[model samples]
Target: MIQRIQTIYLLIASIVSGGLIFVFNLWKTLKEQIFVLDLFEEGLFTLNVVPFMFITSSILSLVTIFLYKNRKLQFVIGRIIILMNLFLLGLLIYLSLTLSGETIVSEKGIGMFLPILVVLLIVLANKAIKKDEDLVKSVDRLR
Candidate 1:
């Protein structure tokens, strides 16, 4: 149901991946320039994928939330979302580390860690979904 704990987690995950990304700066360049890392900015090679991945992750989470009647499918989608977030996290780490000592990126912003938070929330949602599935199976067995 919509009031389930996993639904709340998925909603938060969607908000973090979709909305909060625009609100926070990902990193600052050595030139004191800020990079928000949204879909519109088309400069860096690695960054181009960030926005796409974030949007995909957010969409996946939102879709998974509504698949509550099909717990197995929902769980699988959650796993895919986790993998996407992990890939995004890896890409962000690579970009930050590679650019840190360069003249382009001098400082990383708090938004750089937003994907990590998204991953954590998705995992929690998956766990709760699993628990619900188990509870359902147990009730079926009792009947």
Candidate 2:
């Protein structure tokens, strides 16, 4: 079913994103004591944000899948969750920008791109869920 497909896509995205975060965190901790990449020196504290976002995203994605599976009809709860996620993301970005200061630096860098990618992935997942609901509604109307 369309719902199942959407759920699967969400699951994969969550797992991949979460795995990346876990790995990044692990690496940070492991190399914290060692003088490694100079890249780590700049804004290393910001790296802490990555794991939290990914883990939260993963948990939300899993919860959404389970909720969809059990609900026979479209539920507003999923949309609420998605909205809350967007709010949380916005807060994180605001915090980052405030802390990073007013620099006209390039916004196309990986640090900027990562958060944008995560937001895009979640938005797409939400769209897929909406599509599934629309399909169910169409089928219900025929029956």
Candidate 3:
């Protein structure tokens, strides 16, 4: 049961995060310019939600591995993993933004692949989450 709940949380977070990338891309297309790599350069973007997402995602991923091994509170652990992933992604976007001396870079040349990569990672994580859930259930049944 715990494993199942964790799996659900992972799936939900993955789906939401993946969906958001698409939505953000659409919004970017409609806008005149997009800020891609502001976080790495200016550091202002780091102050926003992006940094939290990166830190949380990294910690959660590591912690989830331990939790899974110990058969601990899987759901909470999974949520943390998902949140961490989201934050990492947010950070990636923030870092990808390019800026000039006093102006932000134009959006015309922004590559589409980075966002796609982020979505791909989320999808893969969701698949792994399902696999983990299955493994946990099998072990539970054996016990």
Q: Which number leads on lDDT?
A: 1
lDDT of each: 0.86, 0.51, 0.45
Question: Which prediction has more favorable TM-score, 1 or 2?
Answer: 1
Rank by lDDT, highest first: 1, 2, 3
Q: Estimate, for each residue in 83-127, the C-alpha lDDT of model 1 and write its tens digit.
A: 998999899888777664485437778878988999999999999
lDDT of 2 by residue, 18-104 (tens): 554333322112214211122344565544444455566667666666766544332354454455456545754654455433343
Candidate 1 global Cα RMSD: 2.1
**How many clashing residue pairs appear in each of the predictions shown?**
0, 0, 10
State every prediction's TM-score relative to the real structure.
0.89, 0.54, 0.38
lDDT of 3 by residue, 36-136 (tens): 32223434645355534533443454445445554435445554454555456455555445324325333433233433443444455456656776787
Q: Find the 10 residues in a row with the least total lDDT in model 2.
A: 27-36
Candidate 1, residue 82: Cα displacement in angstroms equals: 0.7
Q: List the residue pairs that clash in candidate 1.
A: none
Model 1 weakest lDDT span, ten residues long? 31-40
Q: Indicate the residue-level lDDT of 48 in model 3.
A: 53
